[model samples]
Each structure stands twice: as structure tokens, then as C-alpha cells.
Target: MAAILTSLRNTVIAGFVLSLVLILMFLNWGGTLDYNFCAFLVRWLHVISGVMWIGLLWYFNFVQIPNMPSIPDDQKPAVSKVIAPAALFWFRWGAMSTIVFGIILAWQNGYLLDAYTLGAAEGFSVHKNIAIGIGMWLGTIMWFNVWFVIWPNQKIALGIVDAPADAKPKAGRTAMLFSRVNTMLSVPMLFAMVSAQNIY
Candidate 1:
């Protein structure tokens, strides 16, 4: 247990092993591997990826960005050159995984078009569809910002890509502002997602 706990990869593997054990203990394998079960698994994966994505996003907004100014200039390179890049790698990939799995979940549940269209296929009559549609759209927009806007600008701001020195400050500010925009949208997006679950 100690050895597993000391290594992140082992710890994650152990967690999945435990989950599998619990599933096997509680469910009969013969009846459980059906469409609904697969759908539930996809939903679970979607949720886990989303937690990774949003957790890092909040960490940046609520912790790192707000506290950066207090750090001395000499030590700032530790964050800029090392920690920020590592965190951004996970952040961007988490966003990608989240969006991919979310779309798969939506498709598996047979609401891809309805939710995307915000229930327009059914004449806007389904409240749940509308709710999830809003969440999906917001999440998609956030994903887009993370990839196309934030990541490119971050590469410049972090000096992973060469840019004119004057351009760095502008790139950093753009990334920060867009991150803030995503943070603002996150609350409502989460609300819509949760509301969809209970709207029926």
C-alpha cells in the first residue's frame, strides 16, 4: 500500500483495480456488459476527465495566477519554466479528453443532435435536452478557448515558442483574460449540467 501510494501511476492503477473489484463484487458479469452499462462507463470516464480539466483550471485561476505577483522575480522562473509548462500539458490534454469523452457519452445516450440543437429537433419541448445542450455548448466553447486561444498564447507567454519580447506580455494577458472568461462560464455550465440530470 505504501509503495503504491508513493507512486502516482501505481496509485491510479490501484484505484482502477479497486473499482473493478467492487464492480465484480456487486454486479453479475453476464448481465452487466450491455448498452446501458457501456453508457454508464462512458459517463464515468467523461466525469473523471472533466474533473481533471476543471480542477486544473480552478487551480490556475484560484491559486497560481492570483499568487504569482508575490513570488520574487528570481524564483519566478521556477514557475514559468517548469511548473507552468507541466501543468499546462495536463490542462490542455484534460480539456481534450473531456470534450472527446463528453461527445461520446452524448452520442451513446442518443441525444447528440437533440442536445447540440438544444432540442430543436423536438421543437424545444424537452427541458432536459435544453439544459444539457446549454452545458454542452458552454463546455465546447471552453474547450475551444483552451486549445485554440489559451494554448497558443500560453506557448508564446511561456516562451515555449519564440516571439518578439514585446509580444510576450500581450500574449500572456490574452491567455489570462481568456482563462478568466472560461472561469466565469464554468459556474453556469456546471449548473446546466447538473440541472439536466434532475430536470425530469
Candidate 2:
């Protein structure tokens, strides 16, 4: 247990092993392999990816960005050149995985079009679909910002890509603003998603 806990890869593998044991137990107890079970698994994956993406997003806003100014200028490179890049890699991929799994979950549950259309297929009468649709749209917009806007500007800002020195500040500002935008949207997005599952 100590060895596994000391290594992230091993810890994650152990977690999956535990999940597999749970599934085997369920099957042994007479749970059937079915479409609903498959859909549940997709949703579980979506949630995991979302936690990674949004958790990192919040970490940047709530911790790193705010604390950066206090750090000595000389030591700043440790964060910029090392930590930031590693975190961003996981952040962007987490966003990608979240969106992909979310879309797949929606499709598996047979609400892809209805949710995307905000229940227009049902004349917007289904509150559940409408709620999820709003969350989905918000998530999509956030994902787009992460990939197309934030990542590109961040690359320039972080000096991963070459740009005139003057442009770096501007690029950094742009990325920060969009990241803030996503943070602002995150609360309502989570509300809408949970509402779809529980309230609506």
C-alpha cells in the first residue's frame, strides 16, 4: 500500500483495480451487463476528466496566479518554465477528455440531439434536457476557449512559442482573461449540470 501510494501511476492503477473489483462484485450479485451500465461508465469517465480540468483551472486562479507576485523574480522561472507547462499539459488534455466523454455519454443516453438543440426536438418542454443543454453549451464554449484561445496565447505568453518581448505581456493578459471567463462560467455550468441530474 505504501509503495502504491508513493507512485501516482500505481495509485491510479490500484484505483482502477478497486473499481474492477466492485464491478465484478456487482456482476456476481446478479447485475446484468447492459446499455445503462455502459452509459454510467461513460458518465463516470466524463466526471473524472471534468474534475481534473476544472480543478486545475481553479488551482491557477485561486492559488498560483494570485500568489505569483509574492514570489521572488529569480525563482519565478521554476513555475513558468517547469510547473506551469506540466499543469497546462494536463489541463488541456483533461478538457479534451471531458468534452469527448461528455459527448459520448450524451450520445449513449440517446439525448445527443435533444440536449444539443436544447430540447427543440421536444419543443423545449423537457426541463432536464434544457438544463443539460445549457450546461453542455457552456462546457463547449469553455473547452473552445481552453484550446483555441487560452492555449495558443499561453504558448506565446509562457515563451513556449517565440514572440516579440512586447507581445508577451499582451498574450499573457489575453490568456488570463479567458481563463477568468471560464472560471466565471464554471459555477453556473456546474449548477446546470447538477440540476439536470437531480432537480430537473
Candidate 3:
């Protein structure tokens, strides 16, 4: 138990194994679950990944950034060299997984085209798709910022890339600004995602 607990990979595997066992016990077997049930499962995964991504995003914005100045200068390497990189690894991948699973869930639900096109597709009501569409667009923009803007800048800022000494602060600021942009959008994105179910 201690050995498994000490290893993250083992821990995650154990979790999956436990979940599978629970499914076997609690859920009907023998292909009893259908397409909609599978889609619902995918949606659950998407939501889990999204929560990880946005939770990390908020942690960086609300905790790490503001507290950076207060940490002793000599001890700051613990954060920059170790913690930030680790967090960013999970952060970026969480974003990627969230988008991937979200798209898959959308496709399974048969509204992929409609949501992507913001209800421009035939047979989709504007009211139903609009809310989810806005959420999708916001999520896409946030994903873009995470991959293209924030991660690149963070590489320089965190010294993952060979950046000029004078450029580090600039890179850090750029990353921060984009992260803030995502933070601002998160509220509306969450609203749209939730309202889509109840609104129409």
C-alpha cells in the first residue's frame, strides 16, 4: 500500500482499477449501457479534465503569481525551477485533454458541427446552440492562449528556452496577461456551459 501510494503512476492505476471494480458492481453489465450512456461517461471525463485545467489556472492566478514577491529571493528557485515546470506540465496537458474529450463528447452527442458553427448548421435552434457555442468558443480561445501564448512565454520566463536575459521579464508579463485573459473568460464560459442545459 505504501509503495503504491508513493508512486503516482501506481496510484492513478489503482484509482482506475477501483473505478472499474465499482462499475462492475454498481452498473448493469452485458452491453446494457448504450450510446447515450457512453457519451455521458465521456462527458464526465471532459468535465473532470476541465476542472483540473481551470483549477490549476486559478491557482496560478490567485495564489502563485501574487505570492511570488513575498517568497525569499534565495528560495525562489524552488518555485521557478521545480514547482512551476511541474505545474505547467499538468496545466498544459490538462488543457489538451479537456479539449480533446470535450470535442469527442460533442461529436458523440451529434452536435459537434452545430456547436462549432454556433448553430449555423441546419436543424439546430440558435437558442440551444448559442449558449454551448459561446462556451465552446471561449474554451477554444483559452486553449489557444494556453498553448500558443502562455506556454511559449512561460518557456522563456521559466528558463526552459534560451531567452535573452533582458527578455525574461517581458516573457513573464506576457504569460501573466494571457493567463488573466483566460481567468476573465472562465466565468462566462462556465455560465454558458451550465446555462446551455437549463436555458433551452
Best by lDDT: 2
Residue-by-residue lDDT tens digits, candidate 1, 92-131: 9999999999999999888989999999989999999999
- The local lDDT score (0 to 100) that residue 194 gets in candidate 2 is 97
lDDT of 1: 0.94
**Alpha-carbon shift of residue 111 in model 1 (angstroms):** 0.6
| lDDT tens readout by residue for model 2, 132-153 | 9999999999999999999999
Better of 2 and 3 by lDDT: 2
- Clashes (N, CA, C under 3 Å) per candidate: 0, 0, 0
The lDDT per prediction is: 0.94, 0.96, 0.91
TM-scores, each model vs. reference? 0.96, 0.97, 0.91
As for candidate 1, its clashing pairs are none
lDDT, candidate 1, at 69: 99
TM-score of 2: 0.97
lDDT minimum window of 10 residues, candidate 1: 25-34
Cα lDDT for residue 131, candidate 2: 97
Off by over 4 Å in 1: 28-31
lDDT tens digits, residues 52-157, model 3? 8999999999999999999999999999999999999999999999999989988888878899888986555677687888899999999999999999999999
